[model samples]
Structures are given as C-alpha cells and as structure tokens.
Target: MASKVGHPLRTLVAFFIVIAALYGLMAITKNWTPRLGLDLSGGTTITLTARNTTGKGGVSATSLEQARTIIQQRVDGLGVGESQVTTSGGNQIIVSAPNVQRDELIQQVGQTAELRFRAVYQQESTTPTSQPGNSATAGTGNAQGGSTPSAKASAGTGSASAGATASSTAKGNGRPGPALPTEPPAPPSPRPTAPGKGTPENKAVEWQPSQQDITDFASFTCPRDTQYYPDVSDQPLFTCNEAGTQKYLLGPTIIEGTHVTDANASIGQSGLGWQVNLSFDSTGSKQFEDATRALSQKQSPENAFAIVLDGTAVSVASVDQAIAGGSAMISGGGINQQSAQQLANVLKYGSLPLAFEISSVDTVSATLGGEQLQAGLIAGAVGLALVILFCFAYYRGLGVVVVASLTVAFATTYAMVVLLGASVGFALSLAGIAGAIVAIGITADSFVIYFARIRDEVGEGRGIRTAVETGWRRARQTILVADAVSLLSALILFILAIGSVKGFAFTLGLTTLIDIVVVFFFTKPLVTLLSRTKFYGNGHKFSGLDATHLGVTALPGGRRRAGTATRAATQTGGEA
Candidate 1:
C-alpha cells in the first residue's frame, strides 16, 4: 500500500490530471487571471466619516466595526465583486469597489438607512398608487429602485392600503385572487405636524402638518427629488408610494430600525406570493405594540401605519390589532419575490450604530495599480531567480526536481487564485503578490532538505534506490515540521491583521499549503524515479548525487568510486 501510494508514475499521472482539470476550467471560462483588488483596478473609493447625531463622544471601536460589516453587506448586495470595506482612523469607513458607477455606489452604501415606523396621518394623492407604469424612486416598477421593504405593509393582504394590492391565496398554487379593494381616498386628516419639530434626542411627538407640508403632499409626484428626501424623524414627511399613485403624510417616527433583531423574506404562511418577516428586540417589541394599539383606534387614514425607510414609505397598512410579540410579518401581493428579497436584505443588513457622511470621494486608477503590479512582478522574478540559483549550486542533477516542482506549484497556485477569484470574488492585492513571492523561498527549503538527506544516505554506502527511499523517510518529518510552523505563523497573521495586510496573510497561507501538496505528490516521487536512471544511479561526477562529491568511498555491492576502487586494486597488485 505504501509503495503504491508513493509510486512515481502514479503520482506524476495524478499531478498532470489535476493540472489538466484546472487548465480545462480556464479554457471554458476564458479567465486566465485572478480578480485584481481595488488597489489594482481603477474604481471609486468612498470615505465616509461617521458622526454622532446625539452629540455624544466619538464612535466606539465596536460600533465602527459593526458599521463596517453592514456597509460590506450593502455593497455585496449590489453584486459588486472585489469590493474592499474597512474602517480607517477609528471613525471613518472606506469603501472601494471596481467598475461601479459613482452615484449607484453612493446610494447603496452612503445612506443612513434610518428605518422608522411612522403613522400615516394623511394620504392626499388623487393619483392611484396601483396605476401602471409607475417610475418613481420608491415606486415598484422602477427598474433602478424596485419596491423596497417599506414599500408595502407587513399586514396581510386584507389590510393592504390604497394603490398597493395584495391577495391571500390558499396555497402555493401560483394563482392569486382579484386585487383586494383599496380604501377610497379619505379627506386629509387634521394637520398632523407643526413647523417646530423636536430633535431626535427628544422623544419625537406627532406634529401638526404645516400648510407647506400639506401642499407638498397634495401636489407631490412619486419619485420625489433628492431635495425632498426624508429628513429628521421628528418632522412630518410628505412622500409618495413606490407606484407614484399615492402620496402620504407621516408623523414623527415611533420606532427606529436598530430595534429589529432579525428579518427574513419568504412565501407567506398561507402560501401567498412573498412576505418579509420581522423579529424585534425587547425594546422594539414594546414600542411597536404601543404604536399599533394607538393606530388601530384611529379612523380612516389615521388608522394606517407607514413603514418608512430612509425617509421614504416602502409599505403601509391599517393596524387591525396590537402586536405584542417581538415578531411580525410584512406580506402583500405587491411583495413579489424580487421586492421581498430587497426588503428583507435592507432590514437584515441595515443595522448600523451611527450615521455616515461622505467626506471624500476619490477614484483609484487601475493604471496606478498596474504600475504597482509590475513592480510586484519584478520583485517576484528577482526572488525566484535567487532561489533557482541556489538550487542548481547545491544539487546539480537534483536541481531539475526543484525547478519542476516549483513550476507545478506555480501552475497550481495560479489556477486556484484565478478560480477562487471567479467563484468567490477573492481579489489578489499587491500585498498578496508579495506573499506569493515569499513562497518561493519556502518551497526551495523543502527540496534542499530532502536532497541533502539523499546525499547523506548515498555517502553511507546505500544503492541509489535505497538511498532515495531512506532519505525521504528521514526528510519528510523535517519538511512537515517546517511547513507546519510556516502555516501556523500564516494563520496567526491572517487572524490578527486587517485590511490589505490580511491579503498578505491569506496568500501566504494559501501558497504554503500548495507547497506541501507539490512536495508530497511531485517532488518525492520525481526524485525517486530520477534515481533509477543510469546517469544518476551510477553516480556520474556531476550528477549531484555522485559518489565522489557525496564522499561515498564504497557502494553496497562493494564497488568503490571516488578513487577508492583504483587505490584498492593497486594495493592488491603490489602485494601479489
């Protein structure tokens, strides 16, 4: 079993097969290189400075890190690969992504994503929200911005409000009944806010709608301009439904998004199209319970609740009952698969401790990265040259094994880097390239250790095959020990480091593992097969394993080399 496992032909064949598979994938995908990091690719880099809205001390490390994680999710949700999001200088979050439009990236990660549960005091749109061809910013039909989570109420289809229709289907039969009747346009409720709104720190009180706020809602179109986007939760908001068919007047925020503990989007309990289920923390549960009970008692438009996100009403429905449990569901026929997913993602990944303002936006040119990349390659070439020179100097014939093994290792590592980039968005940074170059030295050490052991056994009067086998047994333990230390160091570095430094650690660890694979599957077996050839087996003077160079005076068969045989024959003749 051991012999079969280490057979030269078998090992070589398996090695080639793996290389073939990797090359096949590259051929099929037409991707020969790994995805380059933001540093290597020209793209937008947005630096956001987090501010404490409540006038507290600067943000804590924990809060900064939490914000970093959330922002990363938002970028990932946009499907941008090779994006780098990290905290800098404690209070700043830097986002770098490749090939993304400046405006789109800003909208995805720049918003405060302040989710508020506000009451709909007045909805004065003569326009129907269900109207087709809705192209508003918050409208359901806009391809750029689909129905966000708050676009519809969590309340079932029966409680769905105007312009947004939903049905409670019996099962997953793919059939939905007629659109539920939308409430007739009710007279705008008594003014819901005043011009003098309280700051967010002060518990927000529902305000009386000023003449201006009301007029805006009455004439406001769906997809309002950026100037009209929702602001502080203390003031009343005039915004349109995603469909642009309805306008709404929402009172002060009753609850904020931080209260949400978890959220998910899936088919409704009754198999209705889709729903976003929410689970709030203890504090959020009580606040929601109070808000729902109060709204349920109001009449007409006052009875409805609007789920506002980032100052826009994503969803609204009449509160039919008080919800005490921390968990709630948002289901409406308008909540199709795509909209449901968008809503759930926004809620689940939107948790952040502080608001961010983009302080500086810059472009990272790929040209600069390309220059850096060229330097990294030059450095790698120099390092590899040194390693190859040392191998040939120390082990003439055995140098072939070192070079071949390294070539295989290089091929395998390159293929994996490219494949991982394609499949998992693993970007190779400049630091990572440095790590790969360092790997050359690590790989060279293994061959030197193994070849020296072989020479030592041959010096002890062993045949070439015996020496090769015995040398491997002694050298493998040392090889494993050295690689283990290297791997351990790499793991620790990867764990402790952050940002681009992590790229270095990861590439180092990756290449170390590749080195071990090459040593076991290619290096050992190739050297063993090479020992069987006459030039090496007979210990030619320059074969590196030459008996003369290795200081071997006699072979196992009593054949003497390195002048020992000639000396012995001369002495015997003199005695005769």
Candidate 2:
C-alpha cells in the first residue's frame, strides 16, 4: 500500500502563501518591528505597596489585584505600549512601562484616584494681591481653572457649558476676602473616609465654611496649599485645580466616584467641543439631582459644583437650573478630546480599592538597555551557530535541509512576533530571547528524528524515495507529541507566572507552533522533493546515506554480489 503524504508541491505553495499574507498585513499596519520590553528598550518600573486606609490589619489579595488592574488602566491611557502591571507579595503592585516619561508614569499610576463631587463655596484666583491686606482679583484663564466668564446649563439635558477662557468670578460677592499668607499652615490631620460615604442632609448648599475653615482658605495658595488639607467626604476641602491657577473652598463630598457607573467622551449636544458624559447609579442620581436643584438657586460660583479628584478641583461648572436626570455632562473650553477622554477614563475606572505608597522607582537607561539587547542577540546567535554546526558535522549534505527549514521557521516566527507586537502589544524581552534559543534545539531535534527514521528504513532495504514517506509516517507522531508537550508547558507557565517570565512562555509557545508549521509544510516537503533528486536518491557517499556509511552490503533495492553481504557483515563485526 502506498503511504499517503499530501501533495508536497501544494503544501510548499501554501506555506509561501501564508508568509506572503503575513508580510501583506505588515505592510498594511506600517509596523515592521516588534515592540521591545522595558529591559530591552529602557523604561521605568514603579513598585507600590498597598495600604488599607480603613485601618485594616493587612492588605487583602482582592484589593491588591484590584489596584493593579486600575493602575494598568491608568498606564494604558498614556498610550505606552508593552506596559506591565502585576501584583506581587500579596500587598505590592509592580508597574513597568517602556519609553515613558518617569514623572508622567508616576503621576498616572500613583494617583489614589479619589474622586468627589463638592459644592463650590468660594472660587478665587491664585494670583497674589498687589499689596498686603488687599483683596485678590480674579483673572480670566483656561479650562484647568481661573475665572469662568460664563456658564450655561441645559436644564434636563444632563449637559452644562462654560467658556474655555471664561472668567468664572463669583456672581454675588465680588470682593476678595483676605490677604494671602506668605506661608501655608501645617498639614491637616488624616481625615480619610470610606470612598462613597455621605449623608443626604449634608447637602452641597448646606455646608458653610467654619471660622477655622475660613482661616485655612485665606492662607491657602494654589499648588502649595493642596498638600496641607485632607479631602475627606464629610469635611470641607480647600484646594486648587490641577493647573494651580484657581483655588476653591469646597463643601463636603456630595457624590463619590463609586457611584459613577459609566463615563464617555464625545462631542457635546450643542456641537461645541469635547465633553465627558457621566452615568450614575440610583443613589448617585438622587444625590446629584438634589444637589443640582439646590445649587441652581444660588449665584455664579456658588451655583457651580466642583468635580474634585485627589483633592484637586478638575472642573467647576455652574448650574443654571435643576438637573434631575441620572446623568450629567462636564463641558468646558479647556476640554479637548484628549483631556475629555482622560477624565472619562479616570471616572469610568473609579477609585482603587486601597491607597498605595510608592515603594521604589527604578529606571533603565537606553544605553544599558541597548547593551543588554546586544548581549541577548549574541547569545542567540551563538546557540544557533552551534546547532547549525552540529547538523553539518553529523548529517553532512543533509544539513542543508535543516538550515532551510530553520530559515523558514525563523521567518515565520519573526513575522508573527512583529504582528503580535503591533496587534496586541506583545513585547520581546531577554527571557523571551532565551525561549527562542531553546526552541532552536527543539526544532533541530525534530529534523534529527525524521532523518534517523529515514536512515533506519534505508538500512532495512527500502529505497530513499520510499523511505521518505515511511519515515514521515513513523516520525510524525513523535514530533507532534513532543511539540504538544512543549506548547502545553508554555501555556501553563504563561498562566501561572508573572512579570518577565510570561514573556519567556509566550515566545516558547509561539516558536513551538512555528516548529509544527515548518515541519509539516516546509521541511517534510523539501525532504521529499530532495529524495527524488539523483544526488540524494542515489545515496552518494557525501549524502550521509550510502551503503558503506550504513554498513549495508549495497544501496537498498540494488543487486549485490554473492560475497558482498558476507564481506559487509564481516567488516561491520570487525568495526564493532
């Protein structure tokens, strides 16, 4: 019976077709290179230790994992590719981002993300008064803060609008209160509260600044004074917007981040610029409705509510009328698509379950990363060279087959790595390089197994052409089982391991798959075609399969002299 090996020519064509498809995709994406990991491309690694703000005994695994996920989202917002955020030692979160600014990465991932909605009790410019004991004047400024010139609210549409460069001076009392203090007071006590805890009676309009609160507000300065005050839910907050151009005295938290169900950035209903639409849960909707109703009855700055994040006023929007819907929109001149999306992401992801203290920050320089990359490449090259050398020394002319198959497999693996990098943000780390090197041995082993099977058949009297098919039939199962085991191990490692080790498992599995592809489509077909050629089919001396080399009387299927078998047996016995 004839062994059924599929059409070699068609398989070879299909393999090339797949390669062409990969390159075609690369052309479409315009990304020809794989993304490098932090160790290879230089970046910052931040380690944060989680601490329960509620005075709990220890940080729970659930909270640490939740914090890691939130930090990952924040880092992803920065558009950094190949960023890694993982939990470690139960209470620590490790964040690695390649090619990111250190300060920016720290800011994004390190924020406590405590979001609160408070009524604006007072809004003032941070510009110092010209003379001592004089009231400071409000200056018109950009969206980050200063003075909003005008603000309009569409009653039930869940949208509010303010000028980008508007002066939002308090409407009723235009006089600034007191002279600014040259120095800020000592930091306030730690007044942390459960994220979303607040009562209905502590409405936005009800909380008035106490005598001490007024003193703190008078002495506070934008940017500098922010650190002194703790932004607790039930207490007043004195802080500035992110830009530090405007200062605000805010009432207790009216709504917390936990109540926000969803947020998205889009063009406003008025066809203005960008805005962030916020959705709230049932409790948040009721609280927002009540706050808006009361605030709409007040004057300009008093009518506006401050959207505070991490004790900083991100936005202060005035309400012209009651907004009773379960949704609200934040629109201002300074809110472009980028800022809107950023704000939306922060709100959408909500606050981390636990506060984190940055434990350590380590940065890898580009020069060091380049040096490490060069070392990894050198190691891989050395490994591949040794593999090729062994094949040539042992298999003679058959080494050419090994080299060609490896070349095809390498091309396939490179293309896949590049594609994966572009598509899914996969990065190649040094550990991943080690995995590829190990795969080199696995691939070479496959070729050795197939070739040995063919030699065994030829030694048993089968022609090379016939042996090609029979050898493949015998070797295919072992090759598949071996590759399958490698792939399985890689999958398990990838699932259980963290940090750079996952990179190793990823590349190992990727190369294992490419090994199977090359063996079935490229290597087997090439060997089958070579078996039909005169040089290999004739079992020439250099072909590594001659009768003399195999210790047989003559080439399989050829006539032998009467004494030839006797002489071959005698020589084989003498050599043994």
Best by lDDT: 2
- TM-score of each model, paired residue for residue: 0.71, 0.71
CA displacement after TM-score superposition, residue 478 of candidate 2 (Å): 2.6
Candidate 2 segments exceeding 4 Å error: 1-7, 24-33, 47-96, 119-160, 163-202, 205-221, 227-229, 261-305, 316-350, 353-362, 366-376, 453-467, 537-557, 560-576
What are the per-model C-alpha RMSD values against the true structure? 8.7, 8.3
Q: Please report, as a residue range, the 10-residue window in candidate 2 with the lowest summed lDDT.
A: 133-142
Instruction: Estimate, for each residue in 1-576, the C-alpha lDDT of model 1 and write its tens digit.
Output: 357445788879998999899989988999897887778877899999997754467888988888888888977775555577988998999998876678767766776667777776666444543443321123321110012323233434354354433212311112332322234433433432323445351243334455555445544555544354445566666676665656676777777778988777777656856767778888887887777677666554566667776656767767555666676666552767766665676677875678788899998888887998998898788878887887788677778888898899899999989887777667788888888888888788898888788777665545677778899999999999999998899899987876678788888999999999999988988887777778877777667777655666654444444354445445444110
Error of 2 at 145 (Å): 24
lDDT of 1: 0.69
Q: Model 2: per-residue lDDT, tens digit, 1-576?
A: 123345787789899999999999999999788888887888898999889866578998888888888888877765555578988888899898886777667767777768788887776666533222211111221121111223346333243332122244321233454433446665444443454554343554687665566656666775644345766778778876655666777888888878889887878656867777778889987887778778878755666787777777766776765566577776653667766776677777778888778899998666876787788889889888988898888787889999998888888888998898877678888888788888888889899889878877666556678778899999999999999999999999998987788889999999999999999989999888777777877878887667765566676556662255445435444111
Candidate 1: minimum summed lDDT over ten consecutive residues — where? 140-149
- Once fitted onto the true fold, the runs of candidate 1 whose alpha carbons sit more than 4 angstroms away are 1-8, 23-30, 49-94, 99-101, 118-162, 165-216, 219-236, 242-245, 251-255, 263-278, 282-305, 316-346, 533-535, 538-543, 561-576
